[model samples]
Target: MRDPLSKKVVTIEPSGIRKFFDIVSEMKDAISLGVGEPDFDTPWHIREEGIYSLEKGRTFYTSNSGIKELKIEICRYLNRRFGLYYDYDHEAIVTVGGSEAIDIALRAMLDPEDEVLVPQPSYVSYVPCVVLAGGKPVIIELKEEDEFKLTREGLLNAITDKTKVLVLPFPNNPTGSVMTKEDLAEIVPVLIEKDLFVISDEIYSELTYGRDHVSIAEFPGMRERTIVINGFSKSYAMTGWRLGYAVGPAAIIEQMIKIHQFAIMCAPTTSQYAAIEALKNGDGDVEIMREAYDQRRNYLVKAFHDMGLSCFEPFGAFYVFPSIKSLGMTSDEFATKLLMEEKVAVVPGTAFGSCGEGFLRISYAYSIDNLKIAVERIERFVKKHCE
Candidate 1:
């Protein structure tokens, strides 16, 4: 009998971030900081829109491209916040979530053996999506000293003739690193010179602490070559709504919409309606949540520092990647021992990439009370094993 599974699917590993989640669920009183989900409920105004839609019997399919109102709102939102614009009619496709946008973008553009440069440590889906799209995953390992920003040098060194696309995950998950406009400008020339396309994931664009999140597409000559993927999940606390959008060259978006049309018809009608309210009226709620997250982020950084842990100050997203290399333990061992002994769970940084060894990704999306409890346990565990 022939094997039934596609070898490509078999080669892919499950998400490393969720490795300990099942265990934590069953372990009573465990405080897990591994998940990237926002703790806030969908804001009442946003949820009310969804309820209103249902009450009005607006529970049918939208167009394959999405309702014009939402797409236009997205364009306005991007322009007002990040200084970028797109043709709502031809260049944007509303997706199920940012995850789906990532998958379909890869599917739309990748040809067999097309090399995609994926920077680490990044969101776990980038590599697998590239592979599943029949592209070769070329990893560009971002360094701690560089604060995990992808440098022009790193981009140039990773490119070969086969390289076609680069996945730029900033306001990055796992590490919470961000690339400023200046940082992006340094690499824009490399991309244009090589004629490489970009899939820029900016899902955490709204959660930055000190500076506004800049889009790579904002760089001159980059808007035409970059596919910007963003959504309401992180910013509006609408993760379960499963709504995201991709904006790019109309040619590329046409192909992505073709894939989305056959694979997912449309995003949920209720979610799309709710999302309009999110964009129009949800900014205040998002700002409130962002402030809470910023407070927690600061508390965790100081707690780790006082405990002798080396943690870089992450200005975006809700995570801190703290090094455990000096504690004489691997990231996995440190996380596991802490969970077993103190009922605290964190994702080992290696889940993001091999370069993430000796570090752990702890999310501050939980409440400050939960954060303080977790930090106390972590401090005790660090003392037990510090070199």
Candidate 2:
């Protein structure tokens, strides 16, 4: 009998992060530094609101575009934080998560073989989503010397006549690189000159250490070409709640909503209600979590340097991308051996993209104690292996 499978479904590779996770799960007493999830619980007030929604039987779907209140709150949050305004009615639609928002954006924008300029090492989803949307992903490697920031030259080099979009994953995953206003300003001309649509995944917006998070839309004449994706997941520790939103030009958002309406109908009703509370009263939680993460980041970078591993001191996001090249092993080998020897599970850098191969992404989302233990174990493992 012939196998039942669509070629598209069959061709897609499983996420490299999850594959290593499954392997790590089989080992005992593993201290995982690999996960990107916030270790903190959802803030009490936000949780309470979700509970209140469920109790009030607000379980029914509100609208294909999601609740008006949540969208309004998102608009306010965007304006207050980034000075990027959105017409909540026509320029925004709540999605199940940032993941869904990304999917919808790619599907709605790309025609078959259209090129998407994706900066890497980035979140693993970007290339696959581009492909699934019948678009070609042109991966431009972000260099360590540049703090993994997407360069203006790189953006310019990646664009071609077929280029239709640019997926901006910053503050970047794995790398923890946040582009500054000046940094983004450098790329503005390329976008306008090339007429490329931008998907600005700013999920780590609240986690920056020094400067306030800057959006590309904040640049002159670029708001009309940018889709800003943000959510309560990282900032509010609301990962499991699955709430996010996208804002863009009205025409683009309307097309995206059509895709989302047929595909998801609406985002979770209770999560939307909970997100309203998050937008209104959750700034404190963000500050608290960001402070904790900053402490961990300091500790982890120091520990890596002490252990003789070189790393760029991450300025944003809850991760440290340390070079594994000095260890004389591939990132996969380092992660696997560390898991076996020291019971520490870090993600291999290559999981993000080719540019990540010489590094290891160590998430600092765990407690300080766990971070200490993981670093100590890694030191021992590195010594034994390198010696």
Which candidate tops lDDT? 1
Q: Which residue runs does candidate 2 get wrong by more than 4 Å?
A: none
* Worst 10-residue lDDT window, candidate 2: 15-24
lDDT of 2 by residue, 171-242 (tens): 989999899989988989988988888999999999999778899998988999999998889999999999
The C-alpha TM-scores of every prediction are 0.99, 0.98
lDDT of each: 0.93, 0.91
- How much is 217 displaced in model 1, in angstroms? 0.7
Candidate 1 has an lDDT of 0.93
Residue pairs in collision within model 1: none
Worst 10 residues of 1 by lDDT: 378-387
